[model samples]
Target: MQIKRKLTEREQKLLQILINERNKGIQEIAQLAKTDIHDLKTIIDSAIDELDLSFLNQNKEIDCTLISAYNEKLKNIEHAIDRLAEGNYGSCQKCGQPIPEKRLEALPFALYCVNCQKKKEEKNKEATQRSYPMREEI
Candidate 1:
Protein backbone atom coordinates (compact mmCIF):
# COMPACT_ATOMS: atom_id res chain seq x y z
CA MET A 1 0.00 0.00 0.00
CA GLN A 2 1.27 3.42 -0.85
CA ILE A 3 1.23 5.67 2.17
CA LYS A 4 0.77 9.42 1.78
CA ARG A 5 3.40 11.47 3.51
CA LYS A 6 2.30 13.87 6.20
CA LEU A 7 2.62 17.62 5.80
CA THR A 8 5.35 19.27 7.82
CA GLU A 9 4.44 21.29 10.88
CA ARG A 10 5.00 24.60 9.20
CA GLU A 11 2.96 23.60 6.19
CA GLN A 12 0.12 22.51 8.42
CA LYS A 13 0.29 25.75 10.34
CA LEU A 14 0.25 27.77 7.15
CA LEU A 15 -2.75 25.85 5.89
CA GLN A 16 -4.65 26.60 9.07
CA ILE A 17 -3.74 30.25 8.82
CA LEU A 18 -4.91 30.43 5.24
CA ILE A 19 -8.18 28.78 6.16
CA ASN A 20 -8.68 31.34 8.89
CA GLU A 21 -7.91 34.14 6.51
CA ARG A 22 -10.33 32.74 3.96
CA ASN A 23 -13.09 32.73 6.55
CA LYS A 24 -12.35 36.21 7.80
CA GLY A 25 -11.94 37.61 4.31
CA ILE A 26 -15.30 36.25 3.24
CA GLN A 27 -17.13 37.70 6.24
CA GLU A 28 -15.42 41.10 6.19
CA ILE A 29 -15.61 41.56 2.45
CA ALA A 30 -19.27 40.58 2.30
CA GLN A 31 -20.18 43.09 4.99
CA LEU A 32 -18.10 45.83 3.42
CA ALA A 33 -19.52 45.23 -0.06
CA LYS A 34 -23.08 45.19 1.17
CA THR A 35 -22.68 48.41 3.10
CA ASP A 36 -20.85 50.19 0.29
CA ILE A 37 -23.35 49.10 -2.35
CA HIS A 38 -26.38 49.82 -0.18
CA ASP A 39 -25.44 53.46 0.21
CA LEU A 40 -24.27 53.97 -3.39
CA LYS A 41 -27.58 54.93 -4.94
CA THR A 42 -28.64 57.14 -2.06
CA ILE A 43 -25.28 58.89 -2.02
CA ILE A 44 -25.40 59.57 -5.75
CA ASP A 45 -28.91 61.00 -5.46
CA SER A 46 -27.84 63.20 -2.58
CA ALA A 47 -24.88 64.45 -4.54
CA ILE A 48 -27.14 65.44 -7.41
CA ASP A 49 -29.37 67.46 -5.09
CA GLU A 50 -26.63 69.08 -3.01
CA LEU A 51 -23.86 69.82 -5.48
CA ASP A 52 -23.48 71.91 -8.61
CA LEU A 53 -23.34 70.24 -12.02
CA SER A 54 -19.58 69.76 -12.06
CA PHE A 55 -19.36 68.61 -8.41
CA LEU A 56 -22.40 66.38 -8.76
CA ASN A 57 -20.94 64.68 -11.79
CA GLN A 58 -17.66 64.12 -10.00
CA ASN A 59 -19.32 62.80 -6.86
CA LYS A 60 -21.49 60.37 -8.77
CA GLU A 61 -18.48 59.15 -10.71
CA ILE A 62 -16.50 58.63 -7.54
CA ASP A 63 -19.38 56.79 -5.90
CA CYS A 64 -19.75 54.39 -8.80
CA THR A 65 -15.99 53.81 -8.89
CA LEU A 66 -15.87 52.96 -5.22
CA ILE A 67 -18.82 50.59 -5.50
CA SER A 68 -17.27 48.82 -8.46
CA ALA A 69 -13.99 48.40 -6.61
CA TYR A 70 -15.75 47.03 -3.57
CA ASN A 71 -17.77 44.64 -5.70
CA GLU A 72 -14.58 43.28 -7.26
CA LYS A 73 -13.05 42.69 -3.84
CA LEU A 74 -16.18 40.96 -2.64
CA LYS A 75 -16.16 38.68 -5.66
CA ASN A 76 -12.54 37.74 -5.06
CA ILE A 77 -13.10 37.08 -1.40
CA GLU A 78 -16.04 34.82 -2.06
CA HIS A 79 -14.12 32.93 -4.73
CA ALA A 80 -11.23 32.46 -2.33
CA ILE A 81 -13.57 30.90 0.18
CA ASP A 82 -14.85 28.58 -2.49
CA ARG A 83 -11.31 27.62 -3.41
CA LEU A 84 -10.51 26.87 0.18
CA ALA A 85 -13.47 24.54 0.35
CA GLU A 86 -12.22 22.86 -2.78
CA GLY A 87 -8.75 22.35 -1.23
CA ASN A 88 -7.00 24.69 -3.64
CA TYR A 89 -7.13 28.02 -1.94
CA GLY A 90 -3.49 29.00 -2.42
CA SER A 91 -3.08 27.80 -5.97
CA CYS A 92 -3.00 30.22 -8.89
CA GLN A 93 -5.98 29.93 -11.14
CA LYS A 94 -3.98 30.85 -14.24
CA CYS A 95 -0.76 28.87 -13.78
CA GLY A 96 -1.97 25.85 -11.81
CA GLN A 97 0.89 26.48 -9.40
CA PRO A 98 1.01 27.13 -5.72
CA ILE A 99 1.00 30.86 -5.05
CA PRO A 100 3.70 32.09 -2.69
CA GLU A 101 2.79 32.19 0.96
CA LYS A 102 3.76 35.82 1.31
CA ARG A 103 1.62 36.85 -1.62
CA LEU A 104 -1.31 34.84 -0.34
CA GLU A 105 -0.88 36.32 3.11
CA ALA A 106 -0.83 39.83 1.73
CA LEU A 107 -3.75 39.28 -0.62
CA PRO A 108 -5.77 36.30 0.44
CA PHE A 109 -8.07 36.75 -2.51
CA ALA A 110 -5.38 36.86 -5.18
CA LEU A 111 -6.16 34.70 -8.22
CA TYR A 112 -2.78 34.49 -9.93
CA CYS A 113 0.83 33.82 -9.04
CA VAL A 114 3.29 36.70 -9.11
CA ASN A 115 4.63 35.93 -12.56
CA CYS A 116 1.18 35.26 -13.97
CA GLN A 117 -0.06 38.44 -12.34
CA LYS A 118 2.65 40.44 -14.04
CA LYS A 119 1.76 38.93 -17.37
CA LYS A 120 -1.91 39.66 -16.84
CA GLU A 121 -1.11 43.26 -15.96
CA GLU A 122 1.01 43.60 -19.04
CA LYS A 123 -1.81 42.31 -21.18
CA ASN A 124 -4.23 44.72 -19.57
CA LYS A 125 -1.90 47.63 -20.30
CA GLU A 126 -1.61 46.54 -23.91
CA ALA A 127 -5.37 46.24 -24.23
CA THR A 128 -5.83 49.69 -22.74
CA GLN A 129 -3.30 51.16 -25.16
CA ARG A 130 -4.96 49.55 -28.11
CA SER A 131 -8.39 50.90 -27.18
CA TYR A 132 -7.27 54.52 -27.55
CA PRO A 133 -7.77 56.19 -30.92
CA MET A 134 -4.77 57.43 -32.86
CA ARG A 135 -4.36 61.22 -33.08
CA GLU A 136 -5.29 61.21 -36.76
CA GLU A 137 -8.32 59.03 -36.09
CA ILE A 138 -9.38 61.40 -33.32
Candidate 2:
Protein backbone atom coordinates (compact mmCIF):
# COMPACT_ATOMS: atom_id res chain seq x y z
CA MET A 1 0.00 0.00 0.00
CA GLN A 2 1.21 3.50 -0.89
CA ILE A 3 1.88 5.69 2.10
CA LYS A 4 -0.02 8.98 2.15
CA ARG A 5 2.09 12.14 2.12
CA LYS A 6 1.88 14.47 5.07
CA LEU A 7 0.59 18.01 4.79
CA THR A 8 3.01 20.69 3.67
CA GLU A 9 5.01 22.51 6.31
CA ARG A 10 2.80 25.62 6.13
CA GLU A 11 -0.40 23.62 6.08
CA GLN A 12 0.70 21.50 9.05
CA LYS A 13 1.67 24.56 11.06
CA LEU A 14 -1.63 26.27 10.25
CA LEU A 15 -3.58 23.17 11.15
CA GLN A 16 -1.79 22.86 14.52
CA ILE A 17 -2.38 26.52 15.31
CA LEU A 18 -6.04 26.25 14.40
CA ILE A 19 -6.47 23.11 16.51
CA ASN A 20 -4.72 24.67 19.50
CA GLU A 21 -6.85 27.77 19.33
CA ARG A 22 -10.04 25.75 18.92
CA ASN A 23 -9.23 23.56 21.94
CA LYS A 24 -8.43 26.57 24.10
CA GLY A 25 -11.58 28.39 23.02
CA ILE A 26 -13.82 25.37 23.68
CA GLN A 27 -12.35 24.90 27.17
CA GLU A 28 -12.65 28.57 28.06
CA ILE A 29 -16.25 28.78 26.79
CA ALA A 30 -17.30 25.57 28.58
CA GLN A 31 -15.77 26.83 31.84
CA LEU A 32 -17.51 30.19 31.58
CA ALA A 33 -20.85 28.55 30.70
CA LYS A 34 -20.56 26.15 33.61
CA THR A 35 -19.70 28.98 36.02
CA ASP A 36 -22.62 31.02 34.74
CA ILE A 37 -24.96 28.11 35.38
CA HIS A 38 -24.01 28.18 39.08
CA ASP A 39 -23.76 31.95 39.36
CA LEU A 40 -27.22 32.54 37.87
CA LYS A 41 -28.79 29.88 40.06
CA THR A 42 -27.20 31.42 43.12
CA ILE A 43 -28.46 34.83 42.14
CA ILE A 44 -31.97 33.47 41.75
CA ASP A 45 -31.81 31.92 45.20
CA SER A 46 -30.40 35.05 46.88
CA ALA A 47 -33.15 37.28 45.52
CA ILE A 48 -35.65 38.69 48.05
CA ASP A 49 -38.86 37.32 46.44
CA GLU A 50 -38.55 39.47 43.30
CA LEU A 51 -36.35 37.25 41.17
CA ASP A 52 -36.64 37.66 37.41
CA LEU A 53 -36.21 34.08 36.19
CA SER A 54 -35.70 35.40 32.67
CA PHE A 55 -32.29 36.68 33.71
CA LEU A 56 -31.03 33.17 34.36
CA ASN A 57 -32.73 31.83 31.26
CA GLN A 58 -31.24 34.57 29.14
CA ASN A 59 -27.80 33.90 30.56
CA LYS A 60 -28.22 30.23 29.76
CA GLU A 61 -29.39 31.05 26.27
CA ILE A 62 -26.34 33.23 25.62
CA ASP A 63 -24.07 30.49 26.92
CA CYS A 64 -25.78 27.99 24.66
CA THR A 65 -25.28 30.23 21.65
CA LEU A 66 -21.62 30.68 22.45
CA ILE A 67 -21.16 26.97 22.95
CA SER A 68 -22.82 26.28 19.63
CA ALA A 69 -20.62 28.79 17.81
CA TYR A 70 -17.47 27.38 19.38
CA ASN A 71 -18.52 23.87 18.52
CA GLU A 72 -19.11 24.89 14.91
CA LYS A 73 -15.62 26.36 14.77
CA LEU A 74 -14.16 23.19 16.20
CA LYS A 75 -15.98 21.15 13.54
CA ASN A 76 -14.62 23.41 10.83
CA ILE A 77 -11.11 22.92 12.18
CA GLU A 78 -11.63 19.19 12.14
CA HIS A 79 -12.84 19.30 8.53
CA ALA A 80 -9.82 21.37 7.58
CA ILE A 81 -7.52 18.82 9.15
CA ASP A 82 -9.27 16.04 7.26
CA ARG A 83 -8.86 17.92 4.00
CA LEU A 84 -5.20 18.47 4.75
CA ALA A 85 -4.73 14.77 5.30
CA GLU A 86 -6.38 14.12 1.94
CA GLY A 87 -4.12 16.73 0.27
CA ASN A 88 -6.98 18.93 -0.83
CA TYR A 89 -7.13 21.45 1.97
CA GLY A 90 -7.58 24.53 -0.21
CA SER A 91 -10.33 23.40 -2.54
CA CYS A 92 -13.86 24.75 -2.55
CA GLN A 93 -16.50 22.42 -1.17
CA LYS A 94 -19.29 23.62 -3.46
CA CYS A 95 -17.22 23.65 -6.64
CA GLY A 96 -14.16 21.56 -7.39
CA GLN A 97 -11.84 24.53 -7.69
CA PRO A 98 -8.71 25.67 -5.92
CA ILE A 99 -9.23 28.30 -3.27
CA PRO A 100 -6.98 31.31 -3.37
CA GLU A 101 -3.82 31.16 -1.26
CA LYS A 102 -4.66 34.57 0.20
CA ARG A 103 -8.06 33.34 1.31
CA LEU A 104 -6.47 30.30 2.94
CA GLU A 105 -3.93 32.56 4.67
CA ALA A 106 -6.74 34.72 6.00
CA LEU A 107 -9.05 31.85 6.96
CA PRO A 108 -7.11 28.63 7.41
CA PHE A 109 -10.33 26.67 7.80
CA ALA A 110 -12.18 28.09 4.81
CA LEU A 111 -13.93 25.29 2.84
CA TYR A 112 -14.94 27.22 -0.28
CA CYS A 113 -13.41 29.46 -2.90
CA VAL A 114 -14.26 33.14 -2.57
CA ASN A 115 -16.64 33.08 -5.50
CA CYS A 116 -18.60 30.12 -4.17
CA GLN A 117 -18.64 31.55 -0.67
CA LYS A 118 -19.94 34.88 -1.88
CA LYS A 119 -22.59 33.17 -3.97
CA LYS A 120 -23.74 31.15 -0.99
CA GLU A 121 -23.86 34.26 1.18
CA GLU A 122 -25.91 36.07 -1.43
CA LYS A 123 -28.29 33.15 -1.74
CA ASN A 124 -28.76 33.03 2.00
CA LYS A 125 -29.34 36.77 2.11
CA GLU A 126 -31.95 36.56 -0.61
CA ALA A 127 -33.71 33.70 1.09
CA THR A 128 -33.84 35.60 4.33
CA GLN A 129 -35.18 38.69 2.61
CA ARG A 130 -37.91 36.86 0.66
CA SER A 131 -41.47 37.68 1.75
CA TYR A 132 -43.82 34.73 2.10
CA PRO A 133 -47.63 34.37 2.13
CA MET A 134 -48.67 36.91 -0.45
CA ARG A 135 -51.97 38.66 0.25
CA GLU A 136 -54.96 37.66 -1.87
CA GLU A 137 -56.13 40.28 -4.40
CA ILE A 138 -58.77 42.53 -2.82
Candidate 3:
Protein backbone atom coordinates (compact mmCIF):
# COMPACT_ATOMS: atom_id res chain seq x y z
CA MET A 1 0.00 0.00 0.00
CA GLN A 2 1.20 3.52 -0.75
CA ILE A 3 1.54 6.06 2.05
CA LYS A 4 -0.09 9.48 1.89
CA ARG A 5 2.24 12.45 1.85
CA LYS A 6 1.87 15.26 4.33
CA LEU A 7 0.48 18.54 3.05
CA THR A 8 3.00 21.32 2.63
CA GLU A 9 2.46 24.88 3.82
CA ARG A 10 1.30 25.88 0.37
CA GLU A 11 -1.04 22.94 0.18
CA GLN A 12 -2.46 23.88 3.57
CA LYS A 13 -2.98 27.40 2.33
CA LEU A 14 -4.71 26.08 -0.77
CA LEU A 15 -6.93 23.91 1.36
CA GLN A 16 -7.90 26.91 3.43
CA ILE A 17 -8.62 28.87 0.32
CA LEU A 18 -10.80 26.12 -1.04
CA ILE A 19 -12.71 25.82 2.21
CA ASN A 20 -13.27 29.57 2.37
CA GLU A 21 -14.41 29.69 -1.22
CA ARG A 22 -16.76 26.75 -0.66
CA ASN A 23 -18.33 28.48 2.33
CA LYS A 24 -18.77 31.68 0.39
CA GLY A 25 -20.30 29.84 -2.53
CA ILE A 26 -22.70 28.04 -0.23
CA GLN A 27 -23.87 31.33 1.21
CA GLU A 28 -24.32 32.85 -2.21
CA ILE A 29 -26.30 29.85 -3.45
CA ALA A 30 -28.53 29.95 -0.38
CA GLN A 31 -29.21 33.63 -0.91
CA LEU A 32 -29.93 33.03 -4.56
CA ALA A 33 -32.39 30.24 -3.74
CA LYS A 34 -34.17 32.43 -1.19
CA THR A 35 -34.34 35.28 -3.68
CA ASP A 36 -35.74 32.96 -6.33
CA ILE A 37 -38.54 31.90 -4.02
CA HIS A 38 -39.34 35.49 -3.19
CA ASP A 39 -39.24 36.47 -6.83
CA LEU A 40 -41.62 33.68 -7.74
CA LYS A 41 -44.04 34.81 -5.05
CA THR A 42 -43.82 38.38 -6.29
CA ILE A 43 -44.28 37.31 -9.89
CA ILE A 44 -47.37 35.33 -9.02
CA ASP A 45 -48.87 38.25 -7.08
CA SER A 46 -48.06 40.71 -9.84
CA ALA A 47 -49.44 38.43 -12.53
CA ILE A 48 -52.66 37.93 -10.62
CA ASP A 49 -53.09 41.64 -10.05
CA GLU A 50 -52.06 42.77 -13.53
CA LEU A 51 -53.37 39.73 -15.47
CA ASP A 52 -50.13 39.74 -17.54
CA LEU A 53 -47.81 36.75 -17.95
CA SER A 54 -44.94 38.04 -20.04
CA PHE A 55 -42.91 39.37 -17.15
CA LEU A 56 -43.55 36.28 -15.06
CA ASN A 57 -42.02 33.86 -17.53
CA GLN A 58 -39.06 36.10 -18.29
CA ASN A 59 -38.28 36.74 -14.64
CA LYS A 60 -38.54 33.07 -13.72
CA GLU A 61 -36.27 32.10 -16.59
CA ILE A 62 -33.60 34.59 -15.60
CA ASP A 63 -33.74 33.57 -11.94
CA CYS A 64 -33.55 29.91 -12.84
CA THR A 65 -30.54 30.51 -15.06
CA LEU A 66 -28.73 32.46 -12.34
CA ILE A 67 -29.46 29.80 -9.73
CA SER A 68 -28.34 27.07 -12.09
CA ALA A 69 -25.02 28.82 -12.65
CA TYR A 70 -24.45 29.22 -8.93
CA ASN A 71 -25.32 25.60 -8.31
CA GLU A 72 -22.85 24.47 -10.97
CA LYS A 73 -20.13 26.61 -9.44
CA LEU A 74 -20.85 25.21 -6.02
CA LYS A 75 -20.62 21.71 -7.40
CA ASN A 76 -17.20 22.44 -8.85
CA ILE A 77 -15.96 23.87 -5.59
CA GLU A 78 -17.27 20.88 -3.68
CA HIS A 79 -15.58 18.55 -6.10
CA ALA A 80 -12.30 20.36 -5.58
CA ILE A 81 -12.72 20.01 -1.83
CA ASP A 82 -13.30 16.31 -2.30
CA ARG A 83 -10.13 15.99 -4.37
CA LEU A 84 -8.23 17.81 -1.66
CA ALA A 85 -9.53 15.36 0.88
CA GLU A 86 -8.45 12.53 -1.38
CA GLY A 87 -4.86 13.90 -1.50
CA ASN A 88 -5.03 14.77 -5.18
CA TYR A 89 -6.29 18.30 -5.28
CA GLY A 90 -3.49 19.80 -7.38
CA SER A 91 -3.21 16.89 -9.77
CA CYS A 92 -5.01 17.04 -13.08
CA GLN A 93 -7.88 14.62 -13.31
CA LYS A 94 -7.12 13.66 -16.91
CA CYS A 95 -3.32 13.15 -16.85
CA GLY A 96 -2.42 12.75 -13.15
CA GLN A 97 0.04 15.62 -13.32
CA PRO A 98 0.35 18.47 -10.91
CA ILE A 99 -1.38 21.60 -12.15
CA PRO A 100 0.66 24.78 -11.95
CA GLU A 101 0.47 26.71 -8.69
CA LYS A 102 -0.44 29.87 -10.58
CA ARG A 103 -3.28 28.12 -12.35
CA LEU A 104 -4.53 26.71 -9.07
CA GLU A 105 -4.33 30.15 -7.48
CA ALA A 106 -6.40 31.57 -10.30
CA LEU A 107 -8.83 28.67 -10.61
CA PRO A 108 -9.03 26.57 -7.49
CA PHE A 109 -11.57 24.29 -9.06
CA ALA A 110 -9.72 23.43 -12.24
CA LEU A 111 -9.87 19.71 -12.95
CA TYR A 112 -7.23 19.51 -15.72
CA CYS A 113 -3.79 20.94 -16.39
CA VAL A 114 -3.44 23.56 -19.10
CA ASN A 115 -2.31 21.16 -21.81
CA CYS A 116 -4.93 18.59 -20.96
CA GLN A 117 -7.55 21.28 -20.72
CA LYS A 118 -6.61 22.64 -24.11
CA LYS A 119 -6.81 19.19 -25.65
CA LYS A 120 -10.22 18.64 -24.10
CA GLU A 121 -11.46 21.98 -25.36
CA GLU A 122 -10.18 21.30 -28.83
CA LYS A 123 -11.84 17.92 -28.90
CA ASN A 124 -15.11 19.48 -27.76
CA LYS A 125 -14.82 22.14 -30.46
CA GLU A 126 -14.23 19.54 -33.14
CA ALA A 127 -17.21 17.53 -31.96
CA THR A 128 -19.40 20.63 -31.93
CA GLN A 129 -18.23 21.61 -35.43
CA ARG A 130 -19.03 18.14 -36.69
CA SER A 131 -22.48 18.21 -35.15
CA TYR A 132 -23.24 21.70 -36.43
CA PRO A 133 -21.55 21.89 -39.78
CA MET A 134 -21.76 25.26 -41.53
CA ARG A 135 -24.04 25.47 -44.54
CA GLU A 136 -22.67 26.47 -47.93
CA GLU A 137 -23.42 30.05 -49.03
CA ILE A 138 -26.88 30.32 -50.58
Give the number of the best model, judged by lDDT.
3
Give the TM-score comparing model 3 with the true structure, all chains together: 0.55
TM-score ranking, best first: 3, 2, 1
Q: After superposition, how far is residue 60 of candidate 1 from its true place, in Å?
A: 24
| Model 2 agreement with the true structure over 1-138: per-residue lDDT tens digits | 121685676666666666675566556554655645456445433641343334435464456656556556655666666667777677788997977666776787778898899999999877766654335622
75 Cα displacement, candidate 1 (Å)? 9.2
Per-residue alpha-carbon lDDT of model 3 for 31-134, expressed as tens digits?
65554545544543344223233443544534656655655665576667666767878988999998887888788878899999999999999999888887
For each of the candidates, the C-alpha root-mean-square deviation to the true structure, in angstroms, is 12.4, 11.5, 10.9
Q: Which regions of candidate 2 are displaced past 4 Å?
A: 1-4, 34-62, 94-97, 118-138
**Candidate 1 worst ten-residue window by lDDT:** 48-57
Model 2's TM-score against the true structure = 0.48
Record all residue pairs in model 2 with backbone atoms less than 3 Å apart, i.e. clashing.
Answer: none
- Whole-model lDDT values for every prediction: 0.56, 0.62, 0.66
Q: After superposition, how far is residue 122 of candidate 1 from its true place, in Å?
A: 0.8
Worst 10 residues of 3 by lDDT: 44-53
